[model samples]
Target: MAALIEMREIVKIYPNGVVANDGVNFSVDRGEIHALVGENGAGKSTLMKILYGMERPTGGEILLDGQPVHFHSSNDAIAAGVGMVHQNFMLVPSFTVAENIVLGQEPLRNGLLDQAEALRVTRELSQQYGLRVEPEAVVDSINVGMRQRVEILKTLYRGAQVLILDEPTAVLTPQETQELFAAVRKLVDQGKTVIFITHKLREVKEISNRVTVMRSGKVMGVVQTEDATRESLARMMVGRDVFLQVNKPPVTRGKKVLEVHNLSYVSETGRTMLHNVSFNVYGGEVLGIAGVEGNGQTELAETLSGLRPAATGTASVNGKAILNTNPRTVRLSGVAHIPEDRLTNGLALTASIDENLIVDRYFRPPFHRGLFIDYKVVEKQSADLIQEYGIRTPNGKLPVKSLSGGNMQKVIVAREFTSDPALLIAAQPTRGIDVGATEFVRDQLVKQRTDGKAVLLISADLSEVMSLSDRIIVMYEGEITGVFPDAASVSEEELGLYMLGIKRQTKEEMEAVL
Candidate 1:
């Protein structure tokens, strides 16, 4: 059978002479779940962007249904029955799901937005695809899984026979992920072709019929899913055997490094985000905050890191009050934070890697000369850290924006991990990074714990939280729903229950452990 989509000899080179995609030949069969797996900067995204018309290939030939096609914009791709759902959702929060679904192509009645017709179309598509969503619910009030279904229905409403899902399950619970997988299977059974892009090898093995691996701007290998092992695919991605499991040695818990009591935060919009949250991280142990994204996890991390002010309560690091203080003061109080949004809070994108590496301590000690900054010391330190952290850059002189997502994360990890803090707050530290980089980051976090440093971990990846956390706390709607003293004893499903507020421990029960 002929493939539904095909790209031949595709090549894309940026103005900076970076070869994003080199001679790439890719094809997706009709009604098949084709997974595109690769490390960061492996060219998978570039290839998909070209297909979705977000980017133009420097050189390539694309064929759909055995006919040549060129897409100048996303509208062109949508017209050609191709649609993409980006990692970040593109829905308007204030609008209803139905309105968001039929946003651009609203049903017309007397030149007005036919609301009844929009809801009808949304319900029809939702039922047809088994992607259940409430037509009347505001987008802001819906869960992440439902919002994702709305996104998919939006594409299907536009006649997308070929769908591209980019990191679709990156923020979903295990149950939600399974629901999405079921919906995808239904779509495939109904003659829709899906191109799945993710760094998760387990999902690749479970969901895809075939997998294509890419590395260094080129296709490394393509193989049947049943015929490939996770280890094999990971090896192909990074050109070496990657350790999928973390080996953390047992450590003796010591002094309390961080203490939070009745911490509460209200957003700028006056919505309560964190409510009476309390936790303690002791030296030589990892305390993990596990929850669905936006359930006060970001607010909690930001408040504790001094990025945001707390409405009530207290947080102290090593017997010193840190809450509501400046980030620099928090750092000086022996707290190092790896912010969840690296591009926004972590790095100076336009600055050289050397400059970013020394931002926290550029004014202290050796780098701070009497009348001038010591570039020699800064350059040497940056070079050493670049090698030590395995950041894929030729030199430290290049702007941080020039590196890939994983490399940029490595820059943050290098700086934060080397700060010699008593407490480390790692928020989604390995998110959006490939398996190789994820393994590296996980190891570093574990190292901090084993070295007698208190580590506070917040991650949407449930498996990661279970594996790396010594103690786990589940949050729901800005409150602590449950606390597990032994992370290994609890299952992801159990954790998910607390995460969704389906199960809850009494406040006294949680306080006993806390």
Candidate 2:
């Protein structure tokens, strides 16, 4: 039988002489969940963009059901039963789920929008596909996982026969990811084709029928899911034997570095967001904070880092007060924070790589000579860090926005990790990056612990927390639900129960977190 979709000799070259895709060929069988796996900027995104009509390929021919077709825009792709859900959702904040799902294709009743019909059609479509969601819920009020479901439902409602999901599980917790996998299987069983683009190998093995590995703008290999081992797949994606394990050093707990004594935070609307949260990180230890997204994890990190003020609590870094202080004061006191959303808070995208690397230390003595900025010193340091952290960049003089997602993250990792911080607050350090980059980030965090620096790692990725954390804590609904003294002793199932608010720790265990 002919394939459901095919791209013949795809080639895309930008105006800046960057060839994103070169002589690439791709296809997907009807009603199969096909995975497109690669490192960041390895041409997977570019290929998908070409397929979805988001970009006009410099040279390529797309065959749908064995007939040559051309798409001028996403509208053309949509009309041909193709749909894509981006990493950042595009739903309006004040709209309801049903309204957002059927926005452009709304039903009209005598020259008026039919609200009742929208809800009914959305419910029927969601129930038919087993992608359940609250149709009346406000889009902004829902969590990330739920919002993602709405996106999928919208695509299905629009009669999409082929679905493209970009890093679907990047922000989901363990349990939510399981649910998404179930939904993917359901969609495939119902005769829909799915193209999953991601950097996670485990998910590829778990969900895809066939895996296509791309690297450096070309297809590396293609194999059946049953025959592809994670190791073999990693080799294809990165052209190396990628090691995912972290060789942690021996236990050497030292003095407390960060102490949060009954920290409580409230929002501007006067809603108490964080409970009396209390935790302590000792030197030479990594305390992993595990929680579902929106479970007060963001608030906790912001409050501790001085981005958000605490309502009633005391936090000290190295026995010095940090509560209610600005981010500069906290950083000057020997703290380094890697915020969850890097593009917004981490770096200035338009600035040169060297300029961004020196943002935190520009006023320091070594880089500042007689109140004049030292460009040579800055470039030398940035080049050293680029080589040290394996940042794949042509030069430090290039703007940071020119690099791929993984390389951009490496820049942040190098800057913060090399600062010799007394306490490092790494929040989702490898959330959307590739497998190789994730491994490198994990190693750097482990190295910091070995060097006797306290680390507070907050991540929704359970496997990341399990592998790198010496101890683990589960947060749910603005409170710590469980604290595992030894991270290895607890199972993901048990931890997930706490994350879902199905289980709770005893009062004594909560007190022991300090």
Candidate 3:
């Protein structure tokens, strides 16, 4: 079959001389789900952005259905039946589902908005595409899965024949993911082509008909999905045999380094985000917090890390009070935190990489001598860490914001892992990084555990929590719904039950292990 869309010799060079895409060629079939996989900075996103008219190619030509075309803006791409759903959902919180769907192209009756027609159209599209949604439900009040369906419906309502879904399943639970896969298959069966960009190799294998691999701004190869193993695809993307599994050896649990009892948090808007949450992280073991995103995981991490004040309850590190204290106080009590939102909580974007490396310890002995930071010592430490952590950058003096996402994450890891803390609170440590970086970070977490340091791991990735934790706790709404004394003894499906509030253990059952 002839290609439905072809991008030939695409090249994107930023004004700062970064070659995002280098002589790349990509194509997709008319009704197939095609996956694009690559390491961070491999230019997969740039290529797609060019195709979607978000970026102008430095050099290339695009052909759609054997006809040459040029899209100067996203509006042009939309008019040509192309649409993109970003990793972050773009919806107005106050708008109803039907209103969000027909936002820019609302139906009109006598120079006024046609509310009835909008609901009718949304219902029609939702049923026709096999994506279920409530047209009248407010976007803010809906669940993540329902919000995603509304996004797809929005694109379809705009007459999109081709869809680009970026990291669609990043924040979805196992059950919600299956539903999305079913919906995607239905779309393809009804003649819609899809281009899926994701970091999860398993999803690539499961949802894609064909796969294209890229490395360092170039296409490595493209192959039929049935012919590719996860290992093979990972190797192609990173140019090495990446370990898809964590190599964690058995270790004896040690003294309790972190203790929390009835920890609770209420948002400024007066909504209860955490409720009576309790757990313990012992030295030489990892205690995993497993749940779907927005289910009190963020609040718990922030409260423990001193970023948020607790409404009720108490927490401590090594018997020193940490709850409701400031960040520096918690850090002084032997706590190191890798926050979930790296940009906001992890780094000072305007600071140089070397400066950021020492933000947590800038006022200490060697670096701080009589009120002046010793730049020479800081430079040496920064140089050593950059090499040790495999941070790719031209120099240590560049601002943290100038680096790619993966490198910025590496900087955070390098700083936190080397802090020598007694307890590590790692929240989504490897969320956006590639397989190689993920492997490194996971190994480091295990290393910390084996070295007799306590680790409190909170992640939305089920495989990550299951593989690394010695014990696991499941949260639903604002409470601990289930607890497994042995992480290895539980299944992903069983955990999903607690995550979706389908199952809950009595307070006595959870307290026994928690």
Candidate 4:
């Protein structure tokens, strides 16, 4: 089949001397699910932006359907039947689904929007695509998966013949991911071309007809999906052997390092969030908390880490009750926390890397003497931590904001792990990072286990939980549904059943494991 879109020798150079795309040649076949996979900062986004006319390439010629074309802006690209759905959903939270669907191109009657027409069209599209969205429901009221469907529908409503989805499954549950794959297949069956950009090789193998691998702003190769393996793709992208399996050695359970007893928290509106949640983590074991997002996972992590005040409960670190304790006191009590939202809670973006490295330990004796901080000591320690953590930065003096998301996460990991606490609370430690970085982070966590430190790992990724945890606690509706001794013994479907509250375990069954 002829290519629908083709670019020859695409080169994009930023004003900061960053070569986003260098002599890159790419093409997508008509009516096929083509995947683009690479590490972060590998120029996949830049190539897509160039195709969508969000960025103009410094050197290249683009051919669409065998005809040379130039798109000055995204509007031009959209007029040419191209649309992109960003990783972050672009929807007005207060607007209804129908309103968001027909936002920029609302039907008009006598200079006023035709609300009835809009609703009818949205319903028709929803029915045709099996989106199952309520036209009148507010965007904020819907779940993440439904919101993603609305975003896809917005592009379909624009009459796009080609759709670009950037990391569509990043925030979805396993069930939701299957549904999304079904939707993608349906779109392709209806003759819509798709460009899927992701770093996950498994998704590429599952959903894509062909794969294009990029590395350091260049196209490494393109291959048939069936002929390609994750190992092959990793080798092509990183130029090295990649260990696909996590080697978590046997852990020896030691003394209880952290314990949460009868934790209960009520919201400001008198609604219960966590209901008598209790768990224990021993030194040298990773206690994995598994749940669908927003099933009190964030609240549990925050409460245990002393970031949120528990209404009623006791959280102890190394036999010391630390409930309602400030972060400083929690740290002093031998607790280290890797918060979920790295940008908001983990790092001071405006501060220098060196300053962020020592923010949690600056007041201690080695960092500070008497009433003054020792600058030389701080600098030396920060420099060592940066190198030890493998944080990719020019120097520790640079601002944290200048680093990429993965490197910034590394800085947070470095600071928390350097403390060498008795208990480690890792909440979504590898969230939003590339696969390479994720592997590194998981190894570090396993190393912590080897060092006999207790780790409380809260994650939405089922595979990570199954591969890394010694014990799995499934939560549903803010309650522990089931506790399993080995994560490998349980299937994701079984876990999903518990996570969605479709199944429950008896107290006797839970007690046998707990």
Candidate 5:
């Protein structure tokens, strides 16, 4: 088969002198599911951007079906039947699924948008591709998996022949991932070409026919997926023997660190979000909270961290009541929180890295002298934290937004971990980070446990929850439905049942773990 897309010695360099792609020779066969796998900072995204016309290659030639071509912008690439779906969804929150699908290329009747035609096309595409999304549902009201399906549908609706999916499975649950893989297979069977970009080797092995590996702005190698092993891919990407399993000694539970009693809150719509949620976390142990997203997990984390006002009940750190208190008070009471969303809740993106590092402690000594800001001390401390956290940046003066997703997360972790609080609230700590960073973050949590710091670990990644958690609490409809002491012994299927409110445990069963 002739190649659907081809790049010959593509070279891309930014104005900052960072060479993202260098002499990258890549190609994808027509109607094939090709995967691009690499670690953070690799040229995978760069190469894809060049192909999709989001970026202009500094050098090299691109050919489509053996014909040379140049794409000056995304519109040009789209006109050539190429489309890209970014990691972060680009849909308007207020727009309906059907409206988002036909945003740029809406059907027209006379001079106005043809709503009937849009809905009909959306429904036809949904039925044909098995993407069962309600055309009328608002984007914000749907789950992440459904939103991703919408993204795919949007591209397909635009008559895209070559689809580029960037980190598609990063946010999906196991079952949702399976569905997406099935959909990818269907698309390929229907003679569509796909270029999947991801760092997960398992997904590559499962879905890709051929895989191209890139590392540090260079193409490492390309091989058939059937011939490549996870170890081989990891070594090619990182140039090391990566330890997939996190090594931690058995946990020794100590004194009580954090306790929540009958914590309940109400949503803006006057409905109870949490009801009598009670749990206790001990020093030297990680208590994992597992639930489907929007099941009051966000509310619970906010209430416990003093980011949201608890409607009823009390939460305490080291026997000190913190419910209804402000964030500063919570921090002073021996609580440190690693918020779920790093951009909105955890960081000031426009601020310098040094300022973000000292955000939690700017008022304390060393960072502050009476009423004056201590620039020297702050700079030194930020430098030390940056080194300790392995943050990759030229200097602390750079804005936090300049760093990659993993590096930004490192800054947040460095700030919170350096505080040495008695109770740590880590919510989705490894979300959106690469595999290496995920392992590092997990190791840090284990180290905190070893240091006798109680951790309330709320994560949507079931594997992470099962691996690091000393105990597990499953939430359903804003309430604790089941508690398990042996995290490794529990099955994902069983957790899914509790998460979906299909199963529940009696108060006696829950009390034993609590």
Candidate 6:
């Protein structure tokens, strides 16, 4: 059979002289789910963006059904039966699922939108595709998994024959992920093609028919799923053997390092973001918080890190109340924070790598002489960290923006881990980095726990939570729905139900351990 889509010798060069894609060749057959696996800066997203008309390739052409085509914009690609669902959902929160789906092309009767027809069509699509979404449910009121279903349905409703999904399972639980695989198979059975882009190697093995690996803006190889293992795929992507499982020793609980009681946060809009939240994190143990993206995780991280203040609660770091204090005060209290968005909250991109590494320590005696920063000490610290962390950089004096995503993340992790803090707050610490970097970060977190440091880990990736935490807590709608003193007690599927608010532990069960 002829290929459904083919991209030949694709090359993309940015104005800053970054070659995102270099003479790449990729193609997919009809009714096949092709997996694109790569590191953060490996050009998988850029190549797909070019195919979806989000970016124009500097050199190359896309052929659809054996015919060369040019897409000036996303509209052009959509008109040609291609659709993309980004990692972040793009939906109007106030709109219902049906209205959001039919926003661009709604059925009309008597010069008005035909709401009845819209609901009927949505019902039919949901049934036909096995998406299982409620037509009238408002987007804001739905969970992350349901919102993802709405995105898939929207693409199918737009007459998309080739669907491009970027990090579809990044925010889903194990059970929801199984359901999505079922829907993907259904789409393929109906003769549609799917291109799945992800950092997850296991998902590729579970749901894809073929796997393609890319590295440094080039295709390394493509192989049948049956012929690929996580080890093999990872090796292709990163040029070495990578550990898929996190190695951790048994937990030995130590002194209590963090305590929060009746924590409540109200936003500027007078909305209660967190309600009666309470937990304890101890040295030599990592406390993992698992939830969908918007389920008060951000507020909790910010409040605990001194970026936001809780309305009604008391929180202590190392037996001292540090609520509402500035970051410097929190650091002085022997606390370190690895925020969720590395680019935004972790680093100053334009600053030199040396400068970024010493921001928290520049005022110290050794690094600071009188009123001026000691350049010799700064240079030594930067060189030591770069060597110890294995950061791939030409020099410490170069701007941080010159480094790759994984290296930039290493700089943050190295600095935070070396701070000798009693408490560490790591929120999505390895979100978009590669397999190697993720393994390193997880090991570092476990190392801190092993060294008698308290860790609070907040992540959307359920696997990270399960593998690293000594205890697990599930949050939904700003409330603690369940708590497991043992991380191994609940399966990912069981934990996902609580994440979606489908099931909740009794008050007795949650209160005793939490």
Better of 5 and 6 by lDDT: 6
- Residue 318 CA error for candidate 3 (Å)? 0.9
Cα TM-score of candidate 5: 0.91
TM-score of 1: 0.98
lDDT of 4 at 182: 92
Candidate 3 global lDDT: 0.93
lDDT of 6 by residue, 175-231 (tens): 889999999999999989999998888899999999889999999999999998999
Model 2: residues >4 Å from true position, as ranges?
A: none
Model 1, residue pairs in steric clash: none
Across 354-469, the per-residue lDDT of candidate 5 in tens digits comes to: 99999999999988998899999999998898888899998999999999898999999999988989999999998877777777899999999999899999998777888899
What number of clashing residue pairs does each candidate have, in the order they appear?
Answer: 0, 0, 0, 0, 0, 0
Query: Could you list the CA RMSD of all candidates, in the order they appear?
Result: 1.0, 1.7, 1.1, 2.2, 2.6, 1.6
| Model 1 stretches astray by more than 4 angstroms | none
C-alpha local distance difference test of each model: 0.94, 0.90, 0.93, 0.89, 0.90, 0.92
Which ten residues in a row are the worst by lDDT in model 2? 505-514
- Pitting candidate 4 against candidate 5, the one with the higher TM-score is 4
How far off is residue 127 in model 2, in Å?
A: 1.8
Model 6 Cα shift for residue 477 (angstroms) = 1.3
> Cα RMSD (Å) between model 5 and the true structure?
2.6
Order by lDDT, highest first: 1, 3, 6, 2, 5, 4
Q: How many Å off is the CA of 87 in candidate 2?
A: 2.0
Alpha carbon lDDT of residue 62, candidate 1?
A: 95
lDDT digits (tens) for residues 203-251 of candidate 2: 9889999999999999998899999999999999889899967789787
Across residues 1-514, which tens digit of lDDT does each residue of candidate 1 receive?
Answer: 8889999999999998989999999999999999999998899999999999999999989999999999999999999999999889999999999999999999999999999999999999988999999999999998888888999999999999999999999889888899999999999999999999998889999999999999989999889999999999999999999999889899999999899999999999999999999889999999999999989999999999989999999999999999999999999999999999999999999999999999999998799999888999999999999999999888999999988899999999999999999999999999999888999999999999999999999999999999999999999999999999999899998898888888999988988989
Ranking by TM-score: 1, 3, 6, 2, 4, 5
